[model samples]
Target chain A: MLIELQGIVKDYRLGLEIVHALNGIDIRIDQNEYVAIMGPSGSGKSTLMNLIGCLDTPTEGTYFLNGSNVSHMDDDQLAEIRNREIGFVFQNFNLLPRASALHNVELPLIYNGTPASQRRDLAEEALIKVGLKDRMGHRPNELSGGQRQRVAVARALVNKPSIILADEPTGNLDTRTGDEIMDLFEDLHDGGNTIILVTHEEYIAEHSDRIIRLRDGRVERDESN
Target chain B: MQFRESVFIALDVIRNHKMRSFLTLLGVIIGVMSIIGMQSLIEGFQKNIRHQMEQLGASVFQVQKFPVQFGQQDREKYRNRKDLTWDHARVIEQYCTAVAQVGPEAWQWGIMAKYRDRRTGPANHLAGGVPAFFPNNGYFIEAGRALSDTDIQHNRQVAVIGQDILEKLFPYENPIGEHIIVDGRRYQVIGTLEKSGSAFGESQDNRIVIPLSTFLKFYGQNRSLNITVLAASPELMDTAIEQVIGVLRAVRKVPPGEPNDFEIFSSESLIETFDNMTRAVRIGAIVIVSFALLVAGIGIMNIMLVSIRERKREIGIRMAIGARRRDILFQFLVEAVFLSEIGGILGILAGVGIGQLVALVSPVPASIPVFTIVLGFVFCSLVGLVFGVYPAAKASGLDPIESLRYE
Candidate 1:
């Protein structure tokens, strides 16, 4: 298993009331798998995504990422894991608006402590992989929505992590551009990369090999496509 | 993250927000400017004073009837004390083993000198002292000759003229063997002195040297005298002074309990007095400068805090990409330091410029010591670090999830 979560619980305090954001969830994901997690507004899907991305620790339970028990790791350890093992693509693109496409892709490598020349080479290769070879010098604001997302995808892929976790990967795109982004994800999955996408849209989940539906912070259904 | 990357990032951000960064730097600029400017002026005064004192000779001290007066507070006490005389000088020279030589000079200022068609005004200084006075003090005879012991013994009417007097009375003619009149007395000029520069805008070279007997003949015999004593070596200056005091006390027959009725002063003592007077002013200026730096540091902190708040999303993105808390903190700290250092450089240039301007227009000398410039950079960097810590920690401690979600 590439990712395994057992008996996870996350609680948030709203005024004096305790709200369960994630309650006793169990999940297992194998390598090279493409999975979609779908839920309504308060279904804890985003919280699950945060956990899988190592952005947050489970309040209670154990998370085994590639057989490493990371649920109770400190912030620096979690940051190391996030850098080396997990890549994140966000709904808003989350690209530094002032940086060029190549530089944006080079961001993870810079934090990875790669030397400057090698960082440039790897970033260029990643950009080329995302079909942005000619647009490497263009800033995010200068690119279209699809091009911006492609740059984000290149940035996420540059580190060669164990898994890619994307939240609302095409929420801001038009349907045609959204489908194009989905097509790119399909190509990434075909290239033997593990991908976990979080979305509320049914059509987006339908393109995945597996879908897990959640309601009110608990799993409602789990099925293969 | 690497240091180079952090600096590049800082430069990029500063360039993006040029106006804001400049405004943030203004306080540091003014603070460092005042520090450098004040230091230059103080250092200049100290240098000039040291030069003047060096010209007066380092291993020599003076014995007078009264202490070196500043604004004349103890007028009655000094006036009532018995005047120091040639007898005391002779006693110091003979009895004080620590003293190398003693030279006594009686002052007769405002003496006009005339040489046929040329003349000098009453502002010329006229001093009556022995030949030992030239060597004991730092005066070196440039041309003809100094007053010999026989000149004083025989009461000869020969004079040694300073460079200013030579220039005034002779102009183009050779002053040696020229006869000059002082208060209707004819005196032959025997030598001309090398030029000595001014101190505190008073010319040092405008003077004439005549025999003590001749001065007494023309100016009178009952006036007070100043005795200059030279120590055998610099290390024995205090010993020499003590020996002179002992001899004078014995010679004057003062009681054991009462203070000696004479004063011993030196160029070093004069320098000390000047330092004491200016110490309070220097401390006050330092306090004011520190307050300005404090305000400047606070301004940097404020701007850094605002910058952190505005860049929460960027911080989040960096954190997600493997940047640890230390990395974020270091980046912000470097940015703050870079800002302050830029201000420091600008302040140093402006301070030096202003110091030079003051030197050009005013009497106080100004010097820009290299150490002060280095100290300015060090101080400004410290300000950045001290004030930068809080904001950097705040940025570093932000929760990655919350920061990512922050608008």
Candidate 2:
């Protein structure tokens, strides 16, 4: 298993009340897995996604990434892990609006301390992988919505991390563009990448190899397609 | 990589919001300008004063009975030393080899002179000195002739009138051949001096110069001898001074290694003393310039923090993409340093210009200290780097997710 979370629990303190955001979540994901975590609004799905991506630490239990106990990591270690092992894709197509597509893809290598020559080369390669070779110089504002998401995907894939964690990656895209983004995810899964996505749409989850549905701070179903 | 990217990023950020960036750096500009401009003006005054003092005479030194400057006790203790007499000056002339000339002069206070019942009632000044007085003090005789050594030996009652006296006392007559009543004695006017306008504020052309012997009978051996010595050249100054000191020490018989009992004042020494005394003012100026720099640093920090707040989401996106905390920090810091350096450069130019203006309008000459300008640049750059650190660190420390979600 590339990712394993056992008995994970998370709680938030809302002033005087302790609100349980995630409870007894147990899951395993292997390399080449295409998984979507789906739930209605207010379910613990986004909270679980946050934990899986190392954006937050679990309140209880252990999360092992490639056999490393991620739950034990400190803030700096978590950030390091996020940079080296986990790639994140966000709903708003969170590409830096001012940066060129190629430059946007070069960000991970920048944090990775890659020298300039290699950064340019690898960022270009990543842009090519996302079929944005001709749009490398165009900024996000100059690109189409689908082209912007492609740049975001290029950014996620540039570091060659062990897992890609995306939350609502197509929430702002049209059906045609959404299908194209799903196809890219499918392509990345076939290329032996561990892909975890969070969404609320049944059709989006149906395209995944596995779907984990959450309801009211609890995992309601864990099914493999 | 960090440096290059940060520079490019900073430049982009600054360019993207030109107005905001200039406004943010305005405090730094004003602060730097004040320090540079005012310092230049002060430096100009000091320079002009130094030059004016230097021109008094290269080799000349002044001698007075009570030291021109001395401790209260020293003045009192030496107060009774028999006034320097003509014989002592003659002894110095016979002994010191390095001295080129020693002209002793005397001052007559509050006296009245009369010319043919048109009472020129005491001129305010009637000075008595030997002929060597002209060259020793860089003065030249403009009329008939200066008082000769023979005139002093015979005590002949002849006088050299300054131009102002010529205008006032002998406007209707040829003053050189005329006789004037000076201190209850009739004296022939031997010469008239050229108008020597005072380089400083006082008038130089108003005095009457007569021979020491002529002055002695009327004023006599009661007064101290005031002498000026001329050295052959600037190189011979120290040798001449040492020779004079040795002659004085032998005459006074000052004990072997004991400090000289008599005082000597040279133009160089005077210049040195004046410069040394202004040390406190220089220190105060430095402290003030540093304080302005500090305030400028604080201003950079404040403005940078505001910029970070305004760009929180942008920072978060950069971080998420792979920007290390330090990368973000460096980017902001580079921007700050750039802003301040621009201001510092402008300030230095303004400062030099201000100094020039002061020199042009005031009596003082503008002297720009090269060291101060160089130091100002280094200090300004350092201030930018230091003050930008905290804000840069704060930006670097932001959590990516939280920053991204910030509205």
Candidate 3:
């Protein structure tokens, strides 16, 4: 197993009351798996994605990434794990507005202490992989919405992590552009890379080979497509 | 992350927000400007004063009836003291073993010099001194001869003029062997002294020197005399001063256990006095500049906080892209330091320009101290680091999930 979550429970303090965001959840994902986590609003899908991406530690549980228990890790340790093993794709296409697409792709390598000459080559390769070779010099504001999302995808792929965790990657795109991004993801999956996607739309989840549906912080269904 | 990467990012952000960055740097600019500009001026003024004191000759001291006054003093006490005379100079020259030479001098200011048809303005000073005055007062004969012992003993009506008198009275012809009238008295010019520059905006080379015997015959015998004494060598200056003081007290009949009723000063003493007088001004300037830097530092903190608030989502994106907390912190700190360093360089340039400008238009000399430049650079960076901490920490401590979701 590349990732294993055992009895994860997350709670939030909303004003004076405690809300259970994730309640006693357990899941397993192996290497090279294409999985989708689906849920309605306020169903803990985003919370689960945060844990899987190492953006947050589990409030109560054991999270094993490559057989290493990361639930007890501190912030700096989790940041290192995120840098080495997990890549994130946000719904809003979170790219640095002032940086070029190539520079944006280079950011991950920069944090991982890659040499400058090698970092540039890797970022260029990642941009070419995302079919943005001609638009590598464009900034986020100068690119179209689909192209911006492509840049975000390139950034996620630059470090060659164990899994790319994308949250509603097409939430802001039109149907045609959204389908184009999904096709790119299909090509990536065919290339034998692990992918975990979080989405609310049934059509979006249908692209994945396995689906786990969550409701009110609990898994309602788990099935292989 | 590499420091170069943080600096490049900082440059990009500053370029993107040109107006905001300039506004944020204004306080630092002004703070550093005042510090360098004021210090340069003060240093120039001090150098000019020291140069003037040095012109009084090396290892030489003087005795006068009144002390050099700073602010307030008892005027009646100084006025009641006996006037120093040539007799005191004679006694010190005879009794003091460490004294090499004694030159007695008396002067009257605002006297006019007339030659043929040319007349100088009524700002010329007339002085009476023996031949020893030339070496003791740092004056060298540029043309012809200075006053001789025979000229003083025989009371000859001869004068050695300064460069200003030579220029004003004898612009077209030689001043040597020509007679000039001063206060209805005629004296033949025997020589001209070298051009000694002015001090504190007053011309030093605008005077006429005559024999002391002739000066006493014409002016009167009641005027006070200033006695100039040169030590045997530079190393003997302290012993020379002590011997002269003892001889003066004995000649003036100063009682035991009582203070001498005269003042003695030297070039070193004058420099020391100037330092003491300007100490308060230096401290006051530093206090004011420090306050300016304090306020400037506060301004930087406020702006850094605002910048962090505006870029919360950007910080979140960086954090999401695998930036550690320390990486984020270092990035913001570098940006702040870059801003202040730029301000420091600009201020130093402006200060040097101002110093040179003042030197150009006035008599005060200007000099740029390398230490001050380095100090300014270090101080500005320190201010940036101190002020940048809170905002950078706030940025790094932000929750990645919440920051990503920030609207």
Candidate 4:
């Protein structure tokens, strides 16, 4: 198993109330599986994604990535795990505004202590793979929306992470650009990379082999697409 | 994250916000400018004084009726004291065994010198001294013979002119054997003294030296005399001073337990006095500059905090991509240090320029103190570190999840 979540519970304090964002969620994902998590607003899908991404630790239960329990790890250790094991693509394309595409792609490797020489070659290869070789020198603002998303994708893939976790990757894109990103994800899945995507669109979910639906912070349905 | 990366980012940010960075660096610039500029000027002033003292000779001391006064004093106390005369100089020379030589000198300022048609300005200094006075006061004869004892015995109207007088009165001709008129009196020029540069914007080489007897005859017999006493060697200076003081006290009938009516001053004592007087000035300048630096430090902190706030999303993205809290902290710390160091470097340049500018317009020479340059760099770095901590900590301690959500 590549990922295992056992009875994960997450809580939030909204003023005077204790809101249960995640209520006893259990799931298992194997290597190279393309999975989509789907929910409407207030369904705790984002919270669960955050926990899986190691951006937040679970309040209860355990998370095992590659058979190592990571739920109790400290912040820096979790950051290392995020750097080495998972790559994230956000809906809004959270790229550094002032950095060139190549430099943005090299950020993760920089944090991982990669040498400058090798980091550049790897970033360049990743940009080329994402069909943005010509756009490597362009800053985020200089690129089109589609090209920016492609740079973000190149950043996610440059680390050669075990799982690419994308949150609403096409939320800000036009329909045609959105289709292009979904097609790119299909190519990544075909290349034997494990991919986890969170979205509310059913059509986007259809691109994954399996879909897990959440409602009221609980798993409502789980089935192969 | 690598230190180099953080510095590069900082440079990029500063370049993008040129006006803002300059404004932020203003206080540090002013602070360091004042510190370096003031220190250089003060150092130059001290150097000039020390050089003048060296010209006064190392083993020599002076006896005067009045002390060198800085500010206001009770004039009545000095007024009642009897003037030191050539008789006291003779007694010290004869009775003080430790004294090698005693040269009594008196001065009349604003005396004009006329040679043929060429004449010096009325700001000339006319000094009268014995033959020993020339060597004792570091005024070695550059050309011709110094005043001989025969000149003093006969009260001859012969003068040894300084380089300024020579150049002004006899620019193209040799001043030796020439006659010059001073205050309607004609005196033959015997020799010229070597050039001793000016001190404190007043020319040292604008004087005419005549025999003490001749000066007494023309100026007045009642005028006080300043006696310069040189010890046989530097090691005998203290003993020679004591012997001369004893001789003066005995000859002048000063009571044993009362303070001497005259003052004794040496090069070392003058230097010490100059240091003490300027110590307060140095402290005042430092205090004022420190306040400016403090304000500059505060400005850095303020701008850093604002930068953190503005870059919250960037921080979150970095954290999400695997930057540890320490990496974030290091990044911001380096940024702050970079800002201050740039300000420090610019300040040093400006300060040195200001010091040189003053030197160009005046007699004080600009001497760049290497210690102050190093000190400026260290101080600016410290200010950045001290003031940078709070903002950097805040930046590193930011919750990645929350930060990522920040618009």
Scored by TM-score, the top model is 4
TM-score of 2: 0.74
Residue B245, model 4: Cα distance from true site in angstroms = 2.3
Per-candidate local distance difference test: 0.89, 0.80, 0.89, 0.93
Q: Model 2 chain B — which ten-residue stretch has the worst lDDT?
A: B196-205
The lDDT-based order of candidates, best leading, equals 4, 1, 3, 2
Tens digits of per-residue lDDT, candidate 1, A108-211, equal 88887999999999999989988999999999989999999999999999999999898999998999999999999999999999999999998999889999
Model no. 2, DockQ: 0.30
- Per-residue lDDT tens digits of candidate 3, residues B67-111? 877335688778889999988898888989999999999998999
Per-model B-chain TM-score? 0.82, 0.72, 0.92, 0.95
In Å, residue B78's CA in model 4 sits off its true spot by 3.9
Which regions in candidate 3 have their CA more than 4 angstroms from the true location? B46-56, B74-77, B213-223
Check candidate 1 and list the clashing pairs. none
- Model 1 TM-score is 0.88
Query: Candidate 4, chain A: TM-score?
Result: 0.99
Cα misplacement distance, residue B91 of candidate 2 (Å): 7.4
Q: Is the docking of candidate 3 incorrect, acceptable, medium or high quality?
A: medium
Q: Distance (Å) between predicted and true CA of A7, model 3? A: 1.0
Residue B154's lDDT in candidate 4: 95
Top DockQ: which candidate number? Answer: 4
Q: Using Cα atoms with residue i matched to residue i, what is each candidate's TM-score against the true structure?
A: 0.88, 0.74, 0.95, 0.96
Query: What C-alpha lDDT, on a 0 to 100 scale, does residue B300 get in candidate 1?
Result: 96
Better of 2 and 3 by TM-score: 3
After TM-score superposition, what is the CA distance of residue B55 in candidate 3 from its true location, in Å?
Answer: 5.1
